[model samples]
Target: MRDPNPSETASPFGPVISAYSRADAIADGVLVPVPESIAKEAGFRFPVALTSAAWADCVKWTDADSEAQPTPQDETGRLWDVLYVTAHAMKKAPGDREFEVRLYRVPRDGSTGHAKPARLKSVIGPGDDLSPVITIMCPDES
Candidate 1:
């Protein structure tokens, strides 16, 4: 897709993020030089929130086609803290696309990913926050 601002055109898809010099973005599509106000928030991490774009986007080979590589389970078969960014690339080609974010863990480093099928509940305009806030709701319902 064409960048809205040509003066600062070009974006990342991982692998070559370190050379990113734009004040507006980081490698893997994150907004760079993270806004100071956001950094001052109650809780934050070294890496800012993932941008609508993921580290990489493609027609993914998920489930059994890609799931058995390795996982993040412990000896007792419990999951741990290594969460990979699993996102859904919504929207058709031409206009820029958007991603729905979630954190998933693997027992090891190379497990094929599993993405449950989802239906569009509503049309989210653009950017993050498309995810709904359900303080308490049944997993099946959400």
Candidate 2:
């Protein structure tokens, strides 16, 4: 539920997704905060659908000149500071028509880097509903 944007005027790829602590989700039935270890882990997947395409917006570096592009070394301690997806997907179940959702976390802070924000071509449209399948986490500041 927290907006990880660096500034209001900055162009964002999509709404920054928040993480909830596992404890809060079970105790209060709320999902807004993320666990401290999430950043260090490779990634986590939930059985939730990204009903809206807004959740899949992302930043991409389009410049062809490799020398001009920002390197990974420039992003130390700053990648996840903002947050963006490394990978994401939506798939229909094998037997039933129900869809499943997966969002992979990018290692760096994609929200404020030199990349331009771009919409994910693979994102699900407005017709989908992920609230039932996914478990939302607690807010970062909470």
Task: Find the candidate with the highest lDDT and give its number.
Answer: 2
Rate residue 57 of model 1 by lDDT: 22
Superposed by TM-score, candidate 2 places the C-alpha of residue 9 at a distance from the truth, in angstroms, of 53
TM-score of each: 0.18, 0.18
**After best superposition, candidate 2 residue 51: deviation in angstroms?**
8.8
User: In candidate 2, what residue range of length 10 has the lowest lDDT sum?
Assistant: 50-59
Q: Can you give the lDDT of residue 30 in candidate 1?
A: 44
**lDDT of every model, 2 decimals:** 0.28, 0.32
Tens digits of lDDT, candidate 2, 69-137: 344323322223223342222233332322322343232343332544332222212222332223222
- For candidate 1, write residues 43-131 as lDDT tens digits: 22222332222211211224542455543223111111111122122222223333333333332325444423322121223223333
